[model samples]
Structures are given as C-alpha cells and as structure tokens.
Target: MEGGLRRMSHHPRKRVEKAVGALNLAHLQGAFYLLFLGCGMAFILMVWESFMDVF
Candidate 1:
C-alpha cells in the first residue's frame, strides 16, 4: 500500500507540472496574438486619420 501511494504521488506531481507548462504556453500565445491585433488596429486607425486629414 505504501509503495502504491508513493508511485501515485509521483504521477500527480508530474501532471501538475505538465498542467502549469500548458497554462504558461497558453498565456504566451494569447499575449502575442493580442499584441499583433492591437498593432494592426493601431495601423488602420492611423491610416484612417491621415485620410481624414487629407480631405
């Protein structure tokens, strides 16, 4: 029984580590996507503003 518990404990620790790694990767991907979206929107806005000024 003790040996079984010890082995099970190792599995949970490994699972937790994997979950944390996945969460970090998700956060990084989301941040990069948001940054790209923001940059694109800003560029569009700048172009629109310049067009308005020209008119």
Candidate 2:
C-alpha cells in the first residue's frame, strides 16, 4: 500500500503506468471504494452509539 502511494507521487496524470493500466485502474478504484464504505460504516456506528447513549 505504501509502495503504491509512493509510486503515484500525488500526481493525477502520472497515476497509471501503461503496462499495468488495467490492473491499477480496476484495483485502485476498488480499494478506494472499499475504504469509503469502511469509513461510512465507522461513522454510522459512532453516530448510533452516541444516539443510544442519549437515552
């Protein structure tokens, strides 16, 4: 994960290398999507916990 992030150098245009373009595009999006879902669930859990504590 760290290696992949280092490869990007935070540049949009250079994010994908031609040889592994398909692999990178597919998996990177999946990784980001799963990360998004994970964060969403964590936030929901926190909100629910606080709401339950109120009662």
Candidate 3:
C-alpha cells in the first residue's frame, strides 16, 4: 500500500512539471510577438513621417 502511494505521487509531480514548462513557453512566445509588433509599427511610422516631410 505504501509503494502504491509513492508511485501515484510521482505521476502527479511529473504532470505539474510538464504544465509549468508549457506555460513558460507560451509566455516567451507572447513576449516576442509583442516586441516584433512594436518594431514593425515604429518602422511604419518613420516611413510615413519621412514622406510627409518631403511633401
């Protein structure tokens, strides 16, 4: 009975680790996406400003 309890505990610990790893990956991906979006918007604004200056 004691050995069975130990085996059951190990499975849940592994599942927790897997869940934490997946969450970390999702956070990193979201951060990178925001960074790229900000950079693209800045580039577009610069182009627009330069065109306006010429006119």
Candidate 4:
C-alpha cells in the first residue's frame, strides 16, 4: 500500500517535468522562426530600397 501511494505521487511529477521540457523546446523553436522571419523581412526591405534608388 505504501509503495503504491509513493508511485502515484511520483507519476505526476514526472509528467510535469516532461511537460516543462516540451514547452522549452517549443519556445526555442518559436524564437528560431521569429529570427528567420525578421531576417527575411530585412532582406526584402534592402532589395526594395535599392530598386527604388534606380528610378
């Protein structure tokens, strides 16, 4: 009975730990995507500025 109770308590902690790890991974991926998007926008603006200068 005592072992069963202990296992039950530990299970939730393990689940919470897994959830935290997944969240961190998702945060990292989001940051990576934002960085790429910002860089792409900067490149497009630079191109447009140069094209405008030609006219």
Candidate 5:
C-alpha cells in the first residue's frame, strides 16, 4: 500500500485538477447554455434534413 501511494503521481490527473480549480462559475454556466443551444439547433437541422450532403 505504501509503495503504491508513492507512485500515484499521474500527470494528466494533476493537470485536470488544476484546470477544474481555475474555472469561473459564471463562465461555466454560460458555456453550458451555449452548448445546449448548439445541440438544439443541430437536432432541428437534422430532423429537417437541411443540409443532406454535410450531415
């Protein structure tokens, strides 16, 4: 257990932790809202087959 604990310095996990800590709540909320809007637009376009070649 002691040896495993010492070897747990994974680089990607540390970077992700840093990034998560640095985010602003207001910006995150706005990003999510824009993502939701984009997905809704995509769904509508897909259903209507607006751009058959691109889709």
Candidate 6:
C-alpha cells in the first residue's frame, strides 16, 4: 500500500510537468504566429505603398 501511494504521487508530479511543458509550448507557438502575422502585414503594407507611389 505504501509503495502504491508513492507510485501514485510520482505520476501526478509527472503529469504536472507535462502540463507545464505543454503550456510553454503553446505560448511559444502563439508568439511565433503573431510575429509571422505582423511580418506579413508589414510586407503587404510596403507593397501597397509602393504601388500607390507609382500610380
């Protein structure tokens, strides 16, 4: 019974670690997506401005 309890405690700790890692990955992905979107928008705006100048 004591060994079982110890084993159960370790599983929860592992689960907590996995959850934290998943959250960090999600945060990194969000930041990357935002950066990508910002860059794309900036590129589009530059192109539009150049076109306007030509016209």
Position 8, candidate 3: lDDT: 95
Task: For residue 39, give model 1's deviation from the true position in Å.
Answer: 0.7
The lDDT, on a scale of 0 to 1, for candidate 5 is 0.82
How many backbone clashes does every candidate have? 0, 0, 0, 0, 0, 0
Q: For candidate 3, lDDT tens digit of each residue in 15-47?
A: 999999999999999999999999999999999
Model 4, span 6-41: residue lDDT tens: 999999999999999999999999999999999999
Residue 49's C-alpha lDDT in candidate 5? Answer: 87
Top TM-score: which candidate number?
A: 6
Ten-residue stretch with the least lDDT total in model 3: 4-13
- Each model's lDDT: 0.99, 0.87, 0.99, 0.99, 0.82, 0.99
The reply for model 4, stretches above 4 Å from the true place, is none
Count clashing residue pairs in model 2: 0
Pairs of residues at least 3 apart in sequence or in different chains that clash in candidate 4: none
Model 2, residue pairs in steric clash:
none
> Compared with the true structure, what per-residue lDDT tens digits does model 5 show for residues 1-51?
877766676766888887786666667898999999999999998878856
The TM-score values for the models, in the order shown, are: 0.74, 0.63, 0.83, 0.78, 0.47, 0.89
lDDT of 5 at 53: 61
Model 4, global lDDT = 0.99
Name the regions of candidate 5 deviating beyond 4 angstroms.
1-23, 50-55
Pitting candidate 1 against candidate 6, the one with the higher TM-score is 6
Angstrom error of the Cα, residue 46, model 5: value is: 0.2
